[model samples]
Target: MPAEADPASIDAGAALADRGHGHRNEGLAKLAVGAIGIVFGDIGTSPIYAFRETFAGHHQLTPDGLHIYGVLSLVFWSMMLVVSIKYVTIIMRADNKGEGGSLALLALINRVSGNKRWTAPIVLLGVFATALFYGDSMITPAISVLSAVEGITTVEKDFAPFVLPLAMGILAGLFAIQSRGTEKVGQLFGPIMLVYFVTIAVLGIVHIAADPGILIALNPWYAIQFFLSDGLTAFLALGSVVLAVTGAEALYADMGHFGRNPIRVSWLFFVLPALMLNYLGQGAMILSLTPADAAVAIQNPFFLLAPESLRLPLVILATLATVIASQAVISGAFSVTQQAIQLGFMPRLRITHTSASAAGQIYIPVMNWGLMVMVMVLVLSFQTSSNLAAAYGIAVTGAMLIDTCLLAVVLFNLWKWNRFAAMAMLGIFFAIDFAYFGANLTKVPDGGWFPLMIGLIAFTLLTTWAKGRQLMMARMREAAMPISIFVDSAANSATRVPGTAVFMTSSPDGVPHALLHNLKHNKVLHERVILLTVKIADEPFVEQETRCKLEDLGQGFHRLIIRYGFMQEPDVPEALKRLTGCGPAFKMMDTSFFLARQTLLPSSRPGMAIWREKLFAWMLRNAESAMEFFRLPTNRVVELGSQVEI
Candidate 1:
């Protein structure tokens, strides 16, 4: 027999494996707890207004047993089908290298699709979905905080006058604290949300016990009976029922932060059960009341779930949860903006890293202030969460529909799932998405116009920026000299200075504009010349060992390409330090970085409309400079300006 393994060694090996597996499970548990705090806050807070709005909203309905059970049935099945099956089970699996979002997913699909005929349309859909998110971001904070503060009126009728001012003050404070980072505040999120979810679940259990018949709504027939009994009213009620699942997309968008299993665990085991329990209790409470009493209670069913003594405390807790919900959406806006800039869909803006330890903790000043102003305007204009509710579902439903479209591409093209199985699944998604979107369209005259207007404006800006950047790059490439010719001619003709000169270019194959300009003006070349190009890959991150691609073009000229992920911020100086084989080590004092500043001269070219061209030029002018964005030293930088028409 071959030499047998030592018994003690084998036992030790098995014990080590067991220890490693235990650690992984422990880590996943911790992440799941954290996900309950951050990822579920948006949907968790929906119970505060979702059920009440369905009966007392713009198209009000009577709170009779038929309507009550039917609406509850719709809410439960909607979450199970939309939030549970579609997002948690299926879409979460389409993560791009463990990252998920509209832009992240688009990049992944674009890379895999190659140059197929359908690629361009798919990109437009992704960009439009991102644009619609800006509208959603502005409305979330406005409506969440407003609904929470309005609970004060439920506590004391006299407190009604102060609601608007108090809500505005709290919102101002929340936005004010954004520049100071949220790492410390973020630590308390999980525990507080856990308490909120448990409290709501207990409140539901108490009411649900009193009228257990309300649990019969869990059957799907009640939902079908709802539509068949009153088709038109039920169709319009969809606009409001959709609110219960408003933040369902957060599960997929935030999957990168906390992995799929943890978010799934938080939803399946903790968050979803708590949300449905509260909805059921709300329905049960209405059914147990007299007609006149139900009418008054339906005005604020969420707070009335508690006894008189506890309502005030519950109001405070709900307000805090709403604030936390607002914070998550605001931070999401910053992340999406960063991704847009890196992928060339938008111009660069200043990004400040709030935490030294966490790369994802970023603050964008422009986005923060802009959102604050729009939110304040909305709160003032709408005056009540009921009114804001009319403006909400359009953006959310539109994005959901677009996501379904993108999922079609993923199923048939990327994953190559079974055709019949995929089609059946997609059919359910499309039908649900269309019903909600169509219902929301009926509210356009009553405040739904707000998000649609915002979406249209945002989509125009996003598409214009993307098209302008593409045209500008193509024009520059057409005029660029071949790198091989430039190296041979410049190496023999110019004076060789002592230090290294690094010229930044967008393309790896062409000679940079700054290099040509420096040659004509300065009449000298450094001994070590580097043509550096930074390429952002179609993924969330690139490994360190594969980041730098160095090619020596002979005659002391080297072409360096540094690859980064869309989620990463580019630090040119730091990346250069890790690079070797191009020559001597880089030193800040000795090395000079040359950048080209392009001034757009918009002409009647066959590219974009005159109006869009003007808008693109204005955007380019206001963009943050490359030196700050790339983390370059101010002292050792030279900028050469050139004019280009697109």
Candidate 2:
């Protein structure tokens, strides 16, 4: 040995390490509990409708021992393979700096690959996955809430008429409460869900004890046997079976909120066990009944698992769980919208930070109201959870297939995993994803057309906005004069003014149009002129120390580039407050912010269709103002209008 270790120091170091480990374990346990409430809500609530739909849905399956066992086996294995292995184990590892989602994963791959020939298609796949998620988001709330409320009919038939209105009212209330931050309400989620999980588990265990034989469905052979026996029917049943694993994507998407270990711990140890037990319990109850009773029981097997005295309370508990599940999906929508905006795939909508402590806790009023309206319409149109179930699987399966495609890219390209192992995993994922997607295709005429339509519309809007922004930036860049040239001429020609002026632009290399407009109209240059560009990087967060960058130009001119990660909100005033190396400190009252509002003109351009160009124009016109998005001092801001063609 180079030197003898000090025994006391070694003991001290070991004690410190132990303390750190203890703290880490405690944190993980707390986060895992939180993850159970939020991350697993969607999938957790699936047992409410998933089993019922497989039998009572559009493609009705017989609730006999064979079919029941087969379905149960399929559900269990799907949870194991899709949710546990694919998402919890493999896909969660692909997080972008602890952030997980299609956009984050896409950014990670883009940054690593660096303009490979195949990256363009991968990007499109990721965008389409995001698009599909929107459709899924809309359906999730409608179906989840509707299914739970439908349980009221099982308790009392006269409560049936109130189902639609009651569900609608509950949804409206849920949406209405979103303006207030969820941080306070989020605290209770874990405890309430903990109770719910325990209650459901107890109900499952009671039924499981009645006939421990139901445990046989846990075997994969039963699943394969059903496919072998009833090939086409089994294939079509997958359309409904896929609903069991509907929220698997949410696990990976929400990894940033809760760390990978917490989510994994929650799912593998608590959520998965509880869900499988409940599903198995449902199958057991059906098996214990006669054909006639089983037929009626299958219509509402999950609630029937509880005794007559407790059915109503069971319904209430389930409704609460469904509400929590819907809340999680709604929050996910807001998060996704924020990511899309920062990633430049969407227009900047007004975003309200709801919680002072939790930066990620935000409320998007437009998205909330829009989703509310859409969900109300869906509830009104579909009228029943079974009917709504028909529209559900396509978007989810499509998104899953897209995720598999993305995962394939991650495996082969980014991780450079062993070729054989990667292919084997991908082969299984693609097969399952494609089979589910193909089965859901049969649902198109029944109601699957809705999500496809939504996905198409969302895809068109997203792509149009992205392409239009790119073209607009290019046009602006082409027209802009070099900053060095502008500084050389304007510094001496213009009369110097007293205060600082910050001209906002998309590009760092050129003079901003607002600056040009300010010069022409005001006929003066500020003593301290800052040309500012806010850049969103291909990451989730930029450390504060490296965030602000300043470059000095001659004659009191400076170019400021503030880099923000895709998940971060751009706040110019706050950023400027912390900025150093820029000659003088910025004062809100003394600094004037300049922004250019671009009005797009429809041009016969090769870039996009005229219709898409018009759509892009509408989106641009409706986007949140730069002043608001950048959190500038409103009183000291100037807006200049310019017409541009792409």
Candidate 3:
């Protein structure tokens, strides 16, 4: 009754299906492993300090049964609610063409909102969130590595003096290796983290077996009873409990690097289980000790989970794990900075691609060194991980709050969720975020000001650069001459040369100032004149087919618009090679690229304050040359300077 297919066709269809399944399996495996190394590293390393600091930190808590149970419950719920449900399940879906992070999310929201009055406030929130990330970037490396190295004190009292110097050396070495890139380093991260996670889980299980009653902390009633019984003490404990989810934002930020599925799988299957087991195990271990011994154990329960003989080995493993954690945030900083530059929020800086196969693997010298110096200063200033803990939670909590706000926008405007449902979800997230933020605010006198100060400075710089560029573009457009008018007036009268000339401009319809200056001073035009404009899109990567658009203005004059995503670096030479039907084929040696270099003269402009204007002038003066930023052939490029007052 059924029609039989041809044997060859059936075999081919089965083979094709097999190959498709095989590729999907292989891709998923690779992404999951990679996600372990980078996406989960920060949160993975949190157990080292999160448990220890909750009892012995600046806001010290008594190591009684109620307190221990309550704290463990908070940690569990925080990870489940803030990281698992919110980021992994919800916020990650708000990606901008597969890219995630505050900037990418902002671009997505901005694109969907069109031109609403609320857009500006939303943009400011995103910018401030980005500014706070720099502070987190600097502090994560310092605090994580320091906490790992401090494990030495638990091994032997004599090693106490060596903690600071050893941490500094390890951190210094970590920063030193960044210039060489992370391809080789990244290979070891996944395997090492796997071992670390399994080891911690085993450690937790060993102790949990001794005090099976500790498992009761998994019940939400413990957390509720905690708030009811303890009042203000429990309220303030939220700050220390917040550490359990510090690197949660990295889950969303790194979605583009490894897709949503792998990250979610890795977290749900491996990372989350290991973390909960370890925190629960530490709580169980403390419960088994006598009051005096429990007090001593509370000071460094993470490292003490091991036998005396294995302590040193555990410290070594932890140090490696923390280094991997630091690497994740460092790489994130480079990615975010690149996005900002592409999005026109910052001035151009030197960026080097480390892996030819992976465009996302990059090294930025200025950002790397700047982070290293600040990290070192934090180590010296805080002097201990316990002290640094005071400064940690504020930035993370602030970013989390901002993310919730942005997610509300996406839910209402993009996802078209019911208004009541969206608001209900937002209300839950806001309450938790606000509670944690308020708890951290109490830490300002005890070193929390560090992140706040850094945030303020970064926010000022980011806003100033964005506003300055906007004003400069407006001023340039006022003086810009239409390309049609320029060509009609001078096409025949100007003497012609033999080679090709490419003029880079912000406005596609206008002749570039560099072109006007070149024609005025040299009194000659090239045989093939191309007016080129590079536009950055809201997405991460544009397809090759739609990358370039060409127009023939007649009489050997052409207009070309090349588009790139905010996550990409523009290469003028490579883009030109893809252009067709635009006069002659491009040869690097035969083509000369023309760029305009503006010299800012600060005036009493209505746009920005005098100080900000001066600051913008300094930043503009120090920005990398366009030839280098665009990856143009340096020898075949010409820069024409002009003065602009804004």
Question: 1-646 in candidate 3: lDDT tens per residue?
Answer: 1223356744543332222212334577777887898889899999999998889998788898999999999999999999999998999777776678999999878766777888899999999999999999999999999999999988888998999999999999988888888898798889999999999999999999999999899998999999999899899899999999999999989887777778889999999999999999999999888999999999999999998999999999999999999999999999999999998888999999988767888999999999999999999999999999999999999999999999988898777899998888899999999999999999989988989899889999999999999999899988888878888988998999998999998887677899999999999999999999999997677778999999988778999999998988898899898788976679999999999999998899689998999999999999999899999998999999999999
Model-by-model lDDT, in order?
0.90, 0.89, 0.90
Worst-scoring 10-residue span by lDDT in model 1: 15-24
lDDT of 1 by residue, 139-178 (tens): 9999999999999888899999899999999999999999
Instruction: State every prediction's TM-score relative to the real structure.
Output: 0.96, 0.96, 0.96
Order of candidate numbers by lDDT, starting with the best: 1, 3, 2
| Candidate 3 lDDT score relative to the true structure | 0.90
The clash count for each model shown is 0, 0, 0
Runs in model 1 lying further than 4 Å from the true structure: 1-26
Q: How well does model 1 score by local distance difference test?
A: 0.90
What are the runs in model 3 whose C-alpha is more than 4 Å off? Answer: 1-25
- The TM-score of candidate 2 is 0.96
Residue 124 of candidate 2: its Cα lDDT?
A: 91
